[model samples]
Target: MNKFLFGLLLTSCSALGGNSQYVNPFIGTSNFGATHPGAQYPNALASVSPFNVAHGGEQNKFEKDAAWNSRVYIHENRYLTGFSHLNLSGVGCPDAGVLLLMPTTGPLELDAREYGSSYSNEQASPGYYSAQLNKYAVKAEVTSSLRTGLSRFTFPAGQSNVLLNLGLGLTNETGASLKWVSEQEVEGSRMLGTFCYHDEDVRPVFFVARFSKAPKTFGVWKKMPRYQNVEADWIGYNDSIKPYPGYRQLLSGDDIGAWLSFDTREQEAIEVKLGISFVSMENARENLDTEQPGFEFDKLRIEAQKAWDALLDRVEVEGSDEQKTLFYTALYHSLIHPNILQDANGDYPLMGQQGVGNSKQNRYTVYSLWDTHRNVHPLLSLLYPELQADMVRSAVAMAKESGWLPKWELYGMETQVMVGDPATAMIADSYLRGIRDFDVNAAYGAMVRAAEQREHNLLRPENPDYLTLGYVPVDDEGPYDGSVATSLEYYLADFNLAQLALALGKQEDHDKYLARALNYRTLFDADTGMLRPKNRKGEWLTPFDPELGRNFEPAPGYIEGNAWNYRFYVPHDTPGLIQLLGGPEAFLRQLDATFDTGNFDMGNEPDITYPFLYNYLEGQSWRTSRRVRELIAAHFGNHPGGLPGNDDTGTMSTWLAFSMLGIYPVSPGMMDYALFRPSFSKVKIHLSAEYYPGKQFVIENPVGDLDSDKPEAFTLNGRSIDKPFVTHEDIIKGGVLKVK
Candidate 1:
């Protein structure tokens, strides 16, 4: 065995103690969460998810909506076309559900409409999936390694075939190329980009597929235009499009595919293994050879399960079966993105550049930083310090290659989606928590460059105005909105930068950024007790309504939410927020009114920490525990539609995970965790000793009444604490947290 394979086996063996059997991979597959019950190892490069929505016929009725265009939508149950090899989970936008593979019997059919089948007896777990194709009488089972996907298909007697569909995918970007290496192997590449309609940074993903048995007959298929008459064909006029089959070694077009036909007996099984890479087809094959060298289906499936078990075992919990399912599933979802982006040989595509770059460690991608910076990175720093550090290194490397930090990066390309300089906050938070293995100096330099420079297509589009006027101005007459929201995000980013600057002993930068971090105060309107829009003339915009932007409607000064939700988003300075709202009694009254008047949006990130703000108050902190429990019970479950909203690349799940663990990081780039009442009686966290000083951190609620409205007293390591918070240093040092 190779050294990399040996290391992976050792890692998987060490993590075998966790109960991965409790993980329900289908938890957030419905209710618009956009999660897929795919077979994937934790933080792996590829996932084999069922592509059911695109099948024609009765399934088309339920799949007509725009939401069905997502990576995988499980609500529609009429047909099963194939299993897509690369898919995104719990994301709002569509990207990278390509490289589809399907099995069939009888005459070979290339069209998805003709080859689709109805499926039943479906089952899924972490790193494994299985389904019975009723129409073809084929049983399909799949498992995965970090960079490869393995599938075993059982077919009945008669002519059997396996099809590789390159044209049909979840992405809006089209065009692909495929080449056959031999009867049993093929290589291909597909274009992927246009995330949320931003199409400037398109890139190609390459893959290699190998079948266990060589096909008796193999050929390629394409959906080409059909000519009507001889005269019309001479004039290049076409009547319709049809699938044309041929024995071609190479094919390239917007719609093309390949098929392999095999003769098999009853209950005969064929296994296909596929490897994917963003760099080259050679790397793809190498990844497959190194990670999964053989067609050992059951053995690989068991290893995948053990891989997940080791990851979930990091946080062992004592709870009911239902709670355990949700917790482990959330943890599972949290580790899917920021996935390993480099090939096994450490070769990765340089962001915004043409050539491939090499790194010593895994170069991670899919950083939904605007959402994940709030909680996901903090959770990783606490439990998986080495992985978190590698992610930080990935960000720093992106900045070096692309000349700007990534906002919503995917597969080595910046999508420029969402607002905020959140990568800075995430890196700063990790560094403060002792995840400093990355180039801290270079990271700090990147943060400073993003904060000071106003570059095009970067996060700080309104940086000039922000620097000159202390905030981004509302362009009511023009196309721009979200001035208030953007400014507040910048303020948080600046706060995190200031903290990092202070830690690095750069006093001048510390003073400059610390002053800029208060820019959110300039947008606050004392008369309305909420943030409002300001024009270039430094005056509040006329006719403001705090509740105007509800349910994702565009308001004059907000993005995806209203002033009520964004008002308390000053997590870095809650005391200042309370002071702005008046005294403690008035602040509590207004906060209570927000919940009573139905202004709370649990599905969004800005208001996620709103319920936890009560912990900052001394005697009234019990309200946080009460509200957290209520939200979890109302929104989260073990069913298909379990999550309240899009997982935002596991940000929502991380929030639930931290809440159930009885602690939350109120602010990134800070060490303190806001305490809450944990759902379980006992919780144990296995900390990585490479970065943390402790082996384990335990939380015990001996009362066992998770429904308790308030926590009366708290102690850490047998010492009494009057405050409702604990530092990262405190937890990493190892101790028992007892709440009463």
Candidate 2:
């Protein structure tokens, strides 16, 4: 089918049925967006992604470095190493592209440079991927169950081989053990930690791999140590990871792998099933037997597609083909993380511990709370309320097991990557929005603990000083000097905690935290009218520049952002911010100037909500619409480099999805959505019955030109409303929001 016809068919199908057909997984796969066109169910444990960006291949085009090392294949890279199971998508750091399976023919070679091939005829959907290995004349297709990955490879007539390159992974940590379980099965474990180079609390991931057909011959291979001449004596250096042919029953080393050769005719196909677990190899096999016992690739693929379609069908929108594709793809990316971390039998690794625990419900990992707390969690609460509730439960469980709330959790381990106590905000927001399935008191206690604990609190490293000084002071000589940004994040977290406390009838705690939440006032430099760095004695830092932070450069007191971005970050108290900026007139002027002068950083999270701040002003809300439309057109599109920046575990994509739907959760721990002109002609959100009273909520823009900045007369359920905002309660009550 031609591109035009395929697009037309997708449009027709979306118009008549579900909208999952419009999802193009290829978007955000290049230009440092770091997304992959992998195959996985929404929030599933296992994903099968093309592992093509690694070194040691003639067709490999990318340089081997920290910048180029990613979880899976980048769109620009042009080599095929294998199909790796357990991959992460849209993450800035590399981790968890492990358990590689590559199919080849003729002479057997263990090195990726010798055996790896170039691939073409690539195609991917929500839960299915296929590519043709041009060098080996093999067709590779992959699909997945919740915990298991399934791959079917069609080989040309000859001696075909499937290589399980356990040593070749996408992580800095190396060390693996492979043992043959039977003639057709294998079980092993691989070390997969050091997320973002933290190195602490590394954990082993065990796997069980089985073949549908028994191999004619099977053996193991290891990278032998290179001989180094030392004073005329040859000494072996283990650093050289070159493949050495071996048939050992058990191979355990940094660079060791297994291979299985088969005698087959032309177009012969064989299936490989792999199961993964953080606990043990037995649980890995259990997961495989429980989730996917058969070799039915088509069945699993279709079932995975249906699962995605069902999830995407929750929100129906009518729009242009491009708009629909972008909307669904963003939604797809938003559901790929906070994955189910427990095995089928409910066994999971204990966070920061040496033991394992069992849970009745699925434990979730890969929190990335600092990023997802902005919009991703809010969107999930609105759309997938039950899943959101489970996520909250998982967080509470993690805190109870690990002694603290997660900052950047991965596989039950706290990575401590990014600043802020965002888990509080995420849980508070979800509970306030009525998705209260977890222990609220326990959650509140966890937040209080995080707030009070000074030492060993990863979320707030400067807690004691912040509590005493009402702000984190700039440290001229210390390594941790992101005081302004950290203080601002703490204020936001405190504000959310205050809201939760107020709702739970803890008036004293509410007042206490609310007072602390006003610490943003201390950072404001009235003379310059911007939030500047303050010393320990409440003195302003000299020679401050608002636009100094750009191109990933470090600002004096900011984290990955500048003053212009963090200045408008007081979302909890926008009125106070406006007051500090010399009232509404000056506030609007500065806000407009931030955009007019190109000081706004759309790719950065601190300023993502700046465009939506116009909705707070009465007449200037039109500017919000115009700026949002312009940003969407310029930064977001339907291509490989569609995203403006790192997806940040779908926070950026969630922003795009919400923008397209005409509503954004500008404030975390708040129930209301700031309204904007939606790109679609109509949008219908099927509210989850478990948490919401309404069955459906509709937003309709009958006007054809959604790009216009003019305000339309708005009515909710035939009642006129003046404000450009809708509360979560209002949405759950079910009504038509007619914009004319």
Candidate 3:
């Protein structure tokens, strides 16, 4: 740790007093081309876990995406639309926050990509986003929750009217319709929100948005590719978000015109608060009234900070300036979602096959189970076990109502996106880590159903190729026609369940799942000695380019990525994989080769766990050190798009987290950690007496004996545990670690 950075670290921690403010949630705030608004109030999101400041750019809510990207509004996305809300902290895919409202006057039209304007960093903030609508000369600021946000526009003198267009296309490839309830309020949210990229569930999406400023002239418009058809839903009532979604001649991708013009003063600031509700507009209003009453910006800001403090306090860091900055930033990313979906009184509309209604519990949002199951959730369970249990119970309850466990469930819909039975992995890992607070029977049922069903079953398909050939081959006769990714994910998940079941005393189920855990071996191409792909009859794909994408080679590799990424993805079997790679020497060689060749695609998630594999190779300890140091320094920069890939709601940053702490969780259901080189000479994990009374994870550098000019070294609990590897139980129980 450099002295300058380290000194800055001291003052920053000192300011936090009992909690930390060292984390600049705004760091990655601009990354992915936009900054995440760690300030807005989400009733469902526990608090603002501001981990990174990587830039995406400034927006309305610090997090909410705006009309057109202010900085770089390039078509085909590829960067950002300047929108960031109901967003995963770090993951790569884009999801919620639809109905992008832009303020324009004089013959309002649609076609957002064209109508939207651009701005610079000086325009955005937490809970507020401002940009000069290039064409209209209007300055706009936007803010919101997963369901609703408010836009306050200061119009130029000529146009006092504010515009609200439902046809302004957003993500998810769906259009929205507006029913003019009053001059100021439009009763609707984004219609048919985006899918979970993987196309998981096929449920209609709906949200009711109540705007603050009524328009002098307000009406609905249908978006046409080139223009718009402004219409009026005059006498009709917008009952709620439930029944009205599919019953209309709503706008299309072509109909891009809708606007609400409201008269305003020249020097006037019209603040529009749009309350969103999954169940009803009444509920959205109720949520707004409870959390954010009367636009008191200061009050909201304080409340937002308080929420962030509560979560950041879960762990504490003491290190160099840069190290602490990275630490707090990583910590901030950790709590971005699984947002609080219910109202203040504890009620939320469930997104299920049964459709719109209040949930059994406070339904959570921002599920990155596929990305987070590995470490993010595990980290959460380790600190906030009670919350982990609640989340587990929430998953189970959703499964009970929806028939099958949803992949990426949002309000009343299962956007079956992403691969893997991650719900199973999360539950299983939580249970194994001592976070068993759900219906054991129901959880096991979901777990078994996911693993046992035929591959074609919508809820739980029996994987024929997975069952027969041990991998998903292109030539396999189908029921389930997907990628090898699902099988690989299921293999990991099933293994976790098997271990969890064994611990929970479900013997038969344990044995069944245990057998399923070995399914990864089917894809293990012994010829290449790496987990590769094959044809149905067990023949390797011809001219298989492990680096090629799925569409080209299909089942020869997993979905979304190549075999190189997935090859070392066996978290449950590092030792087996190490052995398969020929031993510690060969394992180290191959891992080195993966990185040395620079083919590890830091731009993806599969190989995230790969860097830490050196910990298992006994004598080859330094490799882990080198890789950890290099990865943290290279990909995790302090800029937007600074990420090697989608933060995966924080999985990547969480990887930074463990790396910064000098440890990483290699197994989903295991409590042990594969060690690495600590970025600082010392790091302390704050422990709670409630969960872990009289406990803490203390890392004291072994090089403490050296002078200030000398380099730093590590030691654990006083004695240096030469080589790598540690356990969750070790640190949480609090023993002094001397790494000097």
Candidate 4:
């Protein structure tokens, strides 16, 4: 691309307001154990991928399989599995990509993991997703939104045909059932639910898929072949594979070979309108009318682009073209989840309940706390308070409708994914900091239940061990043997819950949960002074090496990291955690030791929260300045791998955004921000009126000690302040923090 053309494109995108011309939605759309080839549009209510027998799974997943290169049936999971009407972005799990629809001929295998062809990066994009199916010599192009999708497939003129293979599953093969409801409308679908992380996090969702296509000859078939569309439109074999009024097609294969047909005139165009609802097919149709009434391809695309533009303009960055793409793309991904849960008339299906109704507060899904807690949700509390309040409320509602608060929520189902009762911290931190729109009592109830729930992702209980020992024991029988990482997370959650209980005025609950918070002491190895794992026999386990980062899967003992990563995890009671680390000087020394010893793996979440822990430590104020800058430099850039760890959806980027704006959530449940040097010279934060109008955390880089070249100095409005952190309330309620 030439400079003039680039400038023209920039100007055009600017006219569109926020959608970036530089944004290559295809960036993370490929690698990183993800089948992110871009199909299910952001915030869409359906599994809306275009027709094709490819697309493996989430972003960057196929690098492992030997047949990966040849596999065209991309069994997408953790994302809108080829636009099947539902998905969770950025999670490392598999679910909801069932019912493969291929406009093909010949034999089709109900399971797509076979024969699914590999795709190239050059084909996928934000408003468009494309790939070639080697089997049929056909090219599939898909564009989508929460409600509608436009699929255009080009095949050989003479043998033109398309088939809607209704037997495929997103990630799970069995739970998905589809049947035809009416000649035009079909519904009924189930994904038995998904196991998020191990077994602790599970998402049980039932959807009614409504297709705009006319019901033609329909039966349940799995491994059938290809065909094309004869009609200008096609009913997308809505997931009613159960019975009459249901699109249920239980196949033993050979019965449904992608449900065939073809057009003698327009082999060039075949449009598919897919509407999905956890509520019902009626609601799904209602959603389609609400979002895309006519389903005109170009108009919907323009509208989607316009919607994206409005969001992108929230924060404008001045940078190179590539940098702008990476930055804005990150921003785009950040706003995606906690999606618009309420239907057209503002109704939503409550979590843990089968019914649907109006949301008391706005409901959103996709909770990536284990990764996002560090910065993402906090960012929402700061920028989009209303939405944040809605999210907090939704989490609260889940507590009411469901038995416990959600860990990894998709729709209203809690896929007990990841570790920790993170929503505890998220809601507490939000409300305490003044995002009070969510139900306080309900929030408390959810927090309490989360703390009490014994079953975790590992499918083990917090039962005897968590209550008696204060952590997931290394001696547990499951895949997640009790180790340091799980224990540390449990302690932090307990501490956060304690704070929430106190704020809500539940004195007894406060004391109880707070005591649990201090349980980290049980895991603290006083002799070595590092928070380590304790064996079942009441003895501290030796071989305390931080660098190895064991205990997580693929590794095992730790969670998804090692000892060095897990050691600094006591954010809620950092002062207490500090004492366990020996003392302030020892703690800071250990923190510094982390930096110098090359164990500071900024790429992971277990470590990002560490830089902010200094605020709780008395003398370590200065190190935060140096470390935050270094991590930002190392992790964020104009490239794809710029994310350190999983990026855990927007969690990783939230760290960058917050750090750049000059603060860190030392204690999330509390609004206090540990001060850090600003990345940009000046950042005028967009704060909420509730958080004190006209008061934004502003930074002016007079000295610009970005490289840590100058000796650090701290001050408040020209006077040197003794402390390193400022309460978010202090910033909001109007106070001057001048640091130099």
Number of the top candidate by lDDT? 2
Question: Model 4, range 55-154, lDDT digits (tens) per residue?
Answer: 3554434434422221122333221123333444444555555444454434433344443543332243345556566555566666666654556556
Which tens-of-lDDT digit does each residue in 1-740 have in candidate 1? Answer: 23233223323423344567667777777777888887988899988988877856666555665344674646556577888898898888888888999999998778788899888766777788888998899999898989999999999999999999988888879999998888788999999999888878698899999999988898887777764567545546443324444455678988888889989989999999999999999999999999888889888888888888778889989887677777887888999998999999999999988899999898999999989999999999998888898999999999989888889999999898888889989988888999888888888878888888865637688888888999989964233348888888899999999998888898898889989988788988999999889999989988888988876877888878888988898889899989998978888988988888888888888889988888877787789989889999888987777899898999889989999899999899778899888888999999897888898999999755778774558899999888999999999999899888
Report every candidate's CA lDDT: 0.85, 0.85, 0.58, 0.57
For candidate 2, write residues 174-216 as lDDT tens digits.
9999888887899999998888888895888999999999988
- Find the candidate with the highest TM-score and give its number: 2
Alpha-carbon TM-score of each model against the true structure: 0.95, 0.96, 0.80, 0.79
Model 2 alpha-carbon drift over 4 Å, by segment: 1-17, 56-58, 66-68, 230-248, 476-481
Candidates sorted by TM-score, best first = 2, 1, 3, 4
RMSD of 4: 7.5
lDDT of 3 by residue, 530-575 (tens): 6665666677667777666523244345666677777788888888
Where's the lowest-lDDT run of ten residues in candidate 4?
A: 71-80
**Sliding window of 10 residues with minimal summed lDDT for model 1:** 1-10
TM-score (C-alpha) between model 4 and the true structure: 0.79
Provide backbone clash counts, one per model: 1, 0, 97, 104
RMSD of each: 4.8, 2.3, 7.4, 7.5
